[model samples]
Target: MVFTIKKVINNNILCVTDAGGNEMIVTGRGIGFGHKAGQPVNSDAVQKIYHMASMPVQQKLMDLLEQIPYDHFLLTDELVSEIRKKIPYTLNEGLLITLADHISFAIKRKEQGVEFKNPLLESIREYYPEEYRMGKACVQRIQEKLSVDLSKDEAGFIALHIVNAELNTTMSITNDITRFVDGCVKVVESYYGRTFDHESLAFSRLAVHLRFFAQRLFQHEQESDDSMQDQDFRRLIASSCKEHYECAKKIAAYVAETWNQELTEEELLFLTIHLKRINLSSEQTTK
Candidate 1:
């Protein structure tokens, strides 16, 4: 009932082949530290292994993953299972290897108490009600159903797909994105003595910025590159933010006046975020 530490790699994953030609892909964290290949892997370093339906391979992999005691908020099985739902060809070696690193970093970030300011905070609340609701709805309507308990991260991914499809991604739609750009330009021109057309440097730059921003928002990736240093950009953000701020307040008033619900900090933040993006005037309208 003994095992040998096959090898340790710096990339935070272990490729171990032991007694009887059984191999395991184990996550590297708090595991046989400062040790190299052939260094006997201590029993308490492994968490869980990629289990297979094949009983022999499954049992061996399970035992290998079990040698480690503490779980570090990552389940490779969970991630692999989840991603496989969307991209059918994700079971390839490349995805397995790449996602292993991705999952590790994400889990480690959570361990460090890092938080993302969810832009869809209100929709996540008053709109979707809960993460499970959106996730389950997407899962239920799956073109390719996966019979796995989808993780919250997985559900969030699916929810994003739904959002993207709702928002059209095209050149004309991007022109609609430019309409908001025009509004911001007007706001900026009214403030500054500098005169410039939408085709000018200031407006062109911000328009490009907003085009990308709108795309990311539709994709549900709130954290994208949208800076506000130049005058036009700042003005654009200010105009956009002001509109959203007003919309948030309006929503707050409605929720309080009608629904009788007092919106919390989390709820209001995302509401403001989404409203600003939605109000940005995208050609998401056509096609």
Candidate 2:
């Protein structure tokens, strides 16, 4: 199938429309060196073709590729491919462009010796271990392949980006969730007058619960009729575990002040149960 060139981005990349009218970014050595718009692209010379579903994403990739060195794009693609192999979930195709954009900027920052610490690294490491580990490995690969050294904290940023792409969420929302989880931990520690072991299974469970809790809160989902039975059971637990319920209320207050959103009764009940579980485990360890 013949692809008509729509834009000659550079010597290495060409924006083309395939025979089916699908916009694609075709990359090859000297592919666009002597090309012009409306000219037929040399099919034999094409090395990579990115068939994007969204025009905005395609444009974003094109714009990014135009700005950064082609080597950055190549390294970003390799990193994305490695991450996809290690992760269990499927990543969004848009990650191709976003990751490249982030890596290119990071590379420039590294060259200039700028410090870009991810404040949420501790939370990410504790809560999202797999993504965190994958991120570290990715950065190591980046250092080896591109000779750009990034801090371990930068791995946290990359992990969040991966999670954001996987969840089809924005980086802002993912960071907010990280902050929310951190706040929950602070509330628990302050309320109990002690810190729980981050590596504890109970702590991991709490972190997972809080992640989903934050997601539900952000989505502003109302209680469904099917949850009435579960709600009743949780209310029973809340009544029995008054101390835990009080701690849960403090967490809700933190959520309110930080996120400006009130938690539902269902959320409070679930938070109480998770808090109780963590508290009990901590107490047992200290005994």
Candidate 3:
């Protein structure tokens, strides 16, 4: 496919249009160094092609390319590639713009010795372990490539960015989900009168469950009525594990009061089941 250069963004980046007039941003080493509008692009030199369907996102990326050093974009591109490999979801293309902007600002803040703490760091680490691990890798890569060492807090922030991209949601929504999950964990701990070991597999499973639960709450997704088919099992769990079942009730109450979202019977049933497993896991660990 022949690509006509629409604009030269930098020595390595160019805004180009294909034969069908679909605009895209392409990046490569010196791809745009001597290129001009209306010229044919050197396809062999194109290393990355950002075919963002959103015009606003495309424009934002182009503006960012003009503002920040091309190297930052390159670093973020590599990080996004790694993220894709680690995650099961297809990330929004806008991740390139958002993450590149974040890394550029983070580097500048590091240079000025200004560090911001991520309040949701712990929650993010618990809720999005895979993304958090990738975020830590990103921090290490930044240090190796740009000589700027960032804190674990930055890793959390980066993880939230990945979450935002994966869910196609805003950072505020991601923060809300993380905070909600943290609140639910605390509710469970308070009801049990003890903290579950954070590193335990039970806790990991619970965290994963709560993360998606919070997402559903935020999105207002409800379990279908067919979920009631497991009523017999739900009743069995509720009766067999009364204390854990009560703890699950407390969490459900907390969810209702905090988020104003009512949990369905299925949600309550699942929560009770998870709480039962967690309680049993804790019991075995103590014995």
Candidate 4:
């Protein structure tokens, strides 16, 4: 199998996806030497991937993952313990390692100013007032809890985790999407003390989809559910995603009218990709 590497940093870490749809974290100084965004890598090299050591400050490592990425980097256990104590997320080896890889890439992406598209670009403030509030609150919390200064991107990462915890029992994004919509509606209604109306529905719909799609894009099921394949489950997923996004768009439009602030470009970018996936019509939802 041949894999195309889309991103690389420090001439070490890589994000590669193969024809078989496997995305993995690979590390080595020379790995990126001859590579470019669309360059293909040999499967044998992928199979040869090795494990690395963990840091003494893994908790601080977790903190950085909550803010940025750090693959094969040093960390403190106290920092790891502190974050583990605060967040209810299960702390295990796989999660710890994956997060380390993720944060490193995300930090590199941040430096590049990757803009997110908001489906509620016309009226995001009304649809996701709570997110706006949460964004503000996250900054405050980071300021008080963290010893070092962090940027808006870091605050947003922290906010994303909070969003994840509220809707998901496990990291499985399928379950998260189903619950995320209901969760967003509940939070917004309580915040404004009223349920969403039709006018703001488009924006609200976008909000839920973005939250769902962004989280799922990076997640993969470790094992295939035999039952899901036996029963035409891909169709189910595709239709459900379509419904989810359509509803989210309707919700976003509704929120725009309710809130007064403008939606950021970042939000719209996320919404757009989600909508695109759902709108693929007849394509298998899961790859």
Candidate 5:
């Protein structure tokens, strides 16, 4: 489809409108170098087209394009491509703006020798391993392409941004979920009097479950416990795994007290099963 250039954002980026008059931002090397409004965009020069449905988001991206270096936006675009290939999630288009803004600021901070420590770094690494690995790759790419080396803390920060985009939530909510999961894990550890090995499959499973559990809690969602079979299973778990069931109760209590959200029998049942698995794994590791 032929795109009419609405405005030139930079030498590499242009704001264009299609035949239907839907606005989109297109980017490529020198795509807008000599382009002007009312001209047809060189389709061959368009490397990536960002269609932001929200006008505010589109305007924010345009503002970022004008404020930050185009090269940073290009780097973030490349990273977003990599994330799409690696993760099986439909990320929000807002990632382009959030991540590009972050990278630009990170580079400037590096230049000024100013570094911010990510308080959630460890929890982020443990909770979102895939996204954290992608974040590390992003850091390495930045160093290779821009000659600026960023700390692993920045990788954690970037992972949170990825999580934010994936959940279509704010960064604050994503961080809260991470923190909530970490707190639940600690509660389990405290009750068991030992720490579960982070690399253990059981720990991974528990972490994944808790992450979603926290998300549901934050979103005020609850699982249905109306099924008689589900009730039977919950009873079976409570009987078969008494210790783990008690721990799950503790976690449920903590969630109720902290988040003011009550867990349904389904959540409690799943938590009991995960706790049982973690206990078994811990025993095997010790033996």
Candidate 6:
């Protein structure tokens, strides 16, 4: 399909408006050379087309591209492709804008020797080991290709952005979820006087549960008590696994007070059961 050029970004990149009137960023070698607005670009010559999820993100990316070298854009595109292969979930298109813009700024800072440290790097590595590893690999790639060295802290930021893309959530919400899980895990560890295996299947399940649990809290969604009226069943489990139930109660209170959202009985029940398994497994191993 042919695209009408809206603006020429450079010799290799151009802002083109598709037939449907939506503005898109397209790039190819010499595609914009001698091109002007209202000019038509042959689809065959276009190598990459970035359809940003929102205009604000698109504008930010465009503004960044105007200041940074074209290599940054190409590097960001390659990184996104590599990250997609490493991740299990579908990444949102917004990653193109968000990640590209971030890399551009990071490169600029690196060139100027501006040091910015990420305080949550350890938390990210602990909670999202896979993504953090991917992020580290990305740093290596950037160093090799662009001759820019990004710190491990930047890797943490990249991993969180990857998480945001995978979850289709904003960076703020992703950070909130990461902190929420970290806090809850700390509570469990402190209560049992032991650390849970982050790689174990039980711990993975618990992390997944917390991911969704935090999502609900962020969205202000709650389970109705009317549907979970089986107080006797909950009480039976709580009575039998009193210690685990109490631990879960403490966690529930933590989430409630921290997020200002009450945890439903069903949530408390499932959390207690999961913690019971974790606690039992740890005890068995210790004995």
Model 6 TM-score relative to the real fold: 0.89
Question: Which prediction has more favorable lDDT, 2 or 5?
Answer: 5
Cα-based TM-score, every candidate: 0.26, 0.88, 0.92, 0.29, 0.93, 0.89
Sequence-dependent TM-score of model 2? 0.88
For residues 54-93, could you state the per-residue lDDT of candidate 5 as single tens digits?
A: 9999999988999999888888889988888887878888
lDDT of 1 by residue, 58-168 (tens): 444444334432232244445445645654222333333333333344445555766344343323222223323545554343313333333455445333333322343
Q: Is candidate 3 or candidate 6 better by TM-score?
A: 3
Q: lDDT: which candidate is best? A: 5
- Tens-digit lDDT track of model 6 for 1-287: 99999989889888889889999888888999998999898999999888777798788777767777788889888999988887778888788678877888988888898968997888888778889998899899999998888999989889988989987888999989999998999989998887887777677778878877887778677565565578898889889999989999999889878877788878888899899887766667679
TM for candidate 5 is: 0.93
Per-residue lDDT tens digits of candidate 3, residues 39-87?
9986788998888788999899999999898888899889999898888
Badly placed stretches (over 4 Å) of model 1 are: 10-13, 27-29, 42-45, 51-287
Lowest summed lDDT window (length 10), candidate 3: 222-231
Candidate 6 residue runs with Cα over 4 Å from true position: 19-22, 53-60, 224-229
Q: lDDT values of the candidates?
A: 0.43, 0.84, 0.87, 0.44, 0.89, 0.85
RMSD of each: 16.6, 2.4, 1.9, 17.0, 1.8, 2.4
Q: Candidate 3 — which pairs collide?
A: none
Which rank order by TM-score, best down to worst? Answer: 5, 3, 6, 2, 4, 1
CA-RMSD of model 3: 1.9
- What clash count does candidate 3 reach? 0
Error of 2 at 235 (Å): 3.5
What is candidate 2's lDDT per residue for 107-218, written digit by digit as tens? 8998998978777888899888888998898799889998888899889988898888776777888888888888888988899898789988888999988886776677
